[model samples]
Target: MNDEPKSISIKDIAEALNISIGTVDRALHGRRGVSEKTKTRVLKTAEQMGYKPNLAAQALKLNRRISIGVVLPKHISYFFDPLRAGIRAAAGAAMGSQISLEFHEYPRIGSGDIEALEAAHARKYDGLIFLPGDIQRFSPLIRKISRSGTPMMCVGSDAPDTGRIGSVSAHAYISGSIAAELLAHKLPRKANVAILTGELSTLDHAEKLSGFAATLAIQAPHLTLMPTLEGHEKPKEAYRQALTLMRQKDRPEGLYLSTANSIAVIEALEELGLLGKVQVVATDLFQDLATLIKSNKILATLYQRPFTQGKVAFENLVAYLTRGNLESPVVQLAPHIVLRSNLPLFASRISETDEGEPESDSLE
Candidate 1:
């Protein structure tokens, strides 16, 4: 009465099919020299036999190590910390596969991002997973890296026009539309709405704004739209901008935060005694933002699944390096809207952090 599960082996499949072991190996691995008919037969037989490749054993047999570099912005810890944790967790799970992840943090945007990209290139890592600050600005570098035959995967943000291998992120435009749709059902008629975001040059932020504006136009035309306030990914900057916007005679009745600086915006609203008065829709979930949503101060916040994005980005790059499989050109994760009713369920999973490490203005 053995309780251990039985393992399927290639040799067993080959013997059962009365085919040479070499032929079975080539067909199973998708290598050249295997006829399509034979390949199909091998796959069908393998599936019937419940064949599962021993990834660790395969890695040991190869006797090779895959090195990947991760470049991300550390300016906002609430978002990127969970992402980093996910990458580390995935790397730990792949311990026997000999995959190493080297992390490098840069400023949220500008020349610092370029310098980090350059440093990553100089290191000649086997692969790269990065969050692009500005696609147009980094197009050339991205192209150069791709032309060098190194695989690159974009995380959180994408450089689609560039020759990067793939991307993993939330559906930016759809997320924006969700925010607009949520606000439309909650806000008063003829309410004024304003958006606070990071740089518009970045693809992610720009797409979010575009989606939000389009959805609002269709679903909530009564809500007045105001010009965007650029926060530059800084809490203090966002606080100042939020304060200034609220002071105006035509202060916004609804606020949409397209970046991860909701804490600053909430603080500003609290200071002006408008925390519960003005409806708010924010992006990403941190402990503070979750608490705000639970208290009904912030209307709702979108959870982008940053941790899963990081893990997928690393896994995709590793797959390309080891098996030459690019799962897809872009992998967009769906976002979940968290409101007061659902805050308790998501509270334990929130990326709880008071503050991130200090950031510098320039790359050192």
Candidate 2:
């Protein structure tokens, strides 16, 4: 083992520490092992070198097919459509992977524990792509899987310790920055902003708010966003909160929510007949919102490609499985602005592919 940490294998320790391979092997397995003092030395040396068990090698030895199970937040039209498309594109590109992928969707993200747990049973796969629940609770399980050599990836939001693990998602903080810009340009002066949020314990929620507030401090100095109203990740519930906010004497000019479930906000604004007045900005680009954009209702939106997210994850796993390329330990797609006038610019029109050219990704 080197002084600086290394991903040492048994052979490395045998050579570097000048111990016999048999001694090193016995030390590792504890099979009537070596002398306690020698075992301790070997173990200490291995730990100091950052030696980790190789799960991929074992899977290959066991002749396990490389498969990844993808967990998503329901097959709702908003995130699913594009994410599914990206999955297909990525899957096609991962020919060397020789792997299969499956998706498990959960409808009740904010509340349903039973259904979510049941969906975790991916009997045929080797790795996972998780759209996680509460990070404080779910992180340990994710970590445990990673320790066991499963290449776990997450999109949308993630838990703590995600840096050492795997991810293919957006810079949520940048998304918030974009939202701040959208709000800044729409409003003539700085005013109160209201954000509908879910459990703040989630990392994405925290980072996004941080990004929004920090950027607002610099860009829209007069803007004062109120304390978060728990939207419970339900659009209908968010709508109710929007109603209450609209009733306030000092109503906010900007309304931002970090969920695909912010459909409630629209309905709420519609109910108060103040949909036009409230500068609504959020994280989803659903078909109805697209329609509304055409009519000049939605000012702008922040888009993350969930499909590309899923596809990239699959491609990564397959590439690792087939080509042994492990350099890409993390993936970050860029964030883009989608305004009403240029909404069509982002259209992942299936027909666009027939023109013998790739579609434009604005963030690129």
RMSD of each: 10.4, 7.0
Weakest lDDT window of 10 consecutive positions for candidate 2: 350-359
Which tens-of-lDDT digit does each residue in 21-40 have in candidate 1? 78988998899998999999
Error of 2 at 83 (Å): 1.9
lDDT tens digits, residues 144-187, model 2?
Answer: 56554556666666654632245666777887787887788877
Considering only N, C-alpha and C atoms within 3 Å, which residue pairs clash in candidate 1?
none
RMSD of 2: 7.0
lDDT of 1: 0.80
